[model samples]
Target: MESALAARLAAAPEEGIAPVHFVWIVAKDRASGTPSPMGIWSGDEDLTVTVALPDGTTASRAYLGGLGLEVEGLQYVADLTDNPVTVTLSQIAPAAQALVRGLDVRLAPVEVHATTMTGGALTSAPQLQWVGIVDEGPISTPAAGGAGGIALSIRSEIMTQLGQVNPAKSSDVHQKRRAAGDRFSEYAAVIGERKMQWYKR
Candidate 1:
């Protein structure tokens, strides 16, 4: 949170402020050459709000309400669980399933923001709450008339980076990428195969 928002929140009670969740997601992948931004908010009515972009710039984005969005796993626990937030955009019928499928949201950056503890009366802009990358999107369609929607698995930036498999390995070629004369891992392969006589002796 920004310093101003933090100060205002400190004075406001948790229950007194109406926290509005604003989600900004990219609808298409950059490779498709027509990437677009999609914004939605958790509010009764639609309104434009100031949201921060991935590049640290502020933009006025129109957020649609009543679309039905539920955010899960936004908790601070003492346990060591690397849980990803599952955001379900509900009420997406089969007719709109094709539209959702066309969205290349994987690996796209997501920004979640919230208004101050108090509702819109305050002049401060919405504060950024969570930033993550879209891990995957699995869409569900009802066979008859059951409720269904698109579920987006969003992993935090830290968790996403930790989950990535590093290309560099313990080898001569990998070590050379760091430094030309670096040979620390040159014998890594042979050292594991070498046996010690400590057990026999």
Candidate 2:
């Protein structure tokens, strides 16, 4: 089986080898509706998740979190499937706590248009590049630490046939345009500028 690291790196194109950047756009505050900047931080903690497979078995996995990556890198990581991803944040700050108080965060990093840990040589360090929605909740501590941070669990958007994107249907839609001979009309307009740019290429 392919290693998780291999799987994530596979998300990027062969030519992409730039440094990754982690970003988090804290959802707008419930009271003010104002969002937080994509705060970048080092010394991020590891991400762990418990995944239940199709068969009668379960597995626990971990990945590097608290890091950022551009869109290209993020896309690669987001392609990961069949497993749940979760992140744990330590040392909560008052301001950040406000943002995390009650919100589903958006992992919208910057665009990558162009583009871990200790122990021994055998030590494993995986960097998280996946981008998606995550559920957040507060963690309580009974120790003298007296404070804790939020834990983020990746929310899979996958669905059954009813909700899945039909590639064939998309192909048919594009083919219809091809058969239209590139004619533009008031009734037939295309939005999604980014997708249009890709389709044009």
Candidate 3:
């Protein structure tokens, strides 16, 4: 059910794209630990990014590192293994600090419908609808004079959600990623819609 990331981004307003956020939930079928079409399982109020480190002594530290947490006894170490990093976002800290790392959780396709209000333009723009998942999280830097922002890598959920529909394309890696992606994407779309809707309306 994942849609094209390129398509969605293209539809987004060039300006005022900041303060973006996506909230997601575990797919219903996935909630039961089985594979099925993606379904909404929860709301967006209480979702947190989970960072799992390698299964060793470095695990806990690695987890803290991704959060950009600087504690007395804990030193942040970078672990880049193709996965997106996780950070606890806040009002003041709109993004995750740079250097922390995490994996991108893949998922099944979920519908996304977004509405925007352009500065010069008067009325809210038409809703941009699509199906996709955020393959990665955004990488943020220092407030002024830094990487302006980060873009989530989104792709067609159908590209990977092939287990129950077509058992032939059975790959543990893809399935796991698909599930994660689904959870991430669904929440993202839902969260975005809710957040923007009030403003646009």
Which structure among the candidates has the greatest TM-score? 1
lDDT of candidates 1 onward, in order: 0.71, 0.40, 0.31
Cα lDDT tens digits for candidate 1, 1-201: 677677766766753554557787766744664766777766656778777766789889887766566677776667655678877786463312432565667677788777654545533677676788888888777889687688888878787677679876779888888899998888887888988798685
Candidate 1 residues lying further than 4 Å off, grouped into runs, are: 1-17, 29-34, 52-57, 77-80, 93-99, 116-124, 177-179, 191-201
- Distance from true location, Cα of 7 in model 1, Å: 9.1
Task: Name model 2 segments beyond 4 Å from true.
Answer: 1-21, 44-82, 102-128, 143-147, 158-201
- Model 3 worst lDDT window (10 residues): 56-65
Candidate 3 ranges beyond 4 A from true positions = 1-92, 95-111, 116-128, 138-144, 162-201
lDDT of 2 by residue, 23-103 (tens): 344465456656643343333455443333334364454433443321321223444343434444553544345445654
Report the candidate with higher TM-score, 1 versus 2.
1
Order of the predicted models by lDDT, top scorer first: 1, 2, 3
* Ten contiguous residues with the weakest lDDT in model 1: 91-100
Using lDDT as the measure, which candidate wins? 1
Cα displacement (angstroms), candidate 2, residue 129, comes to: 1.6
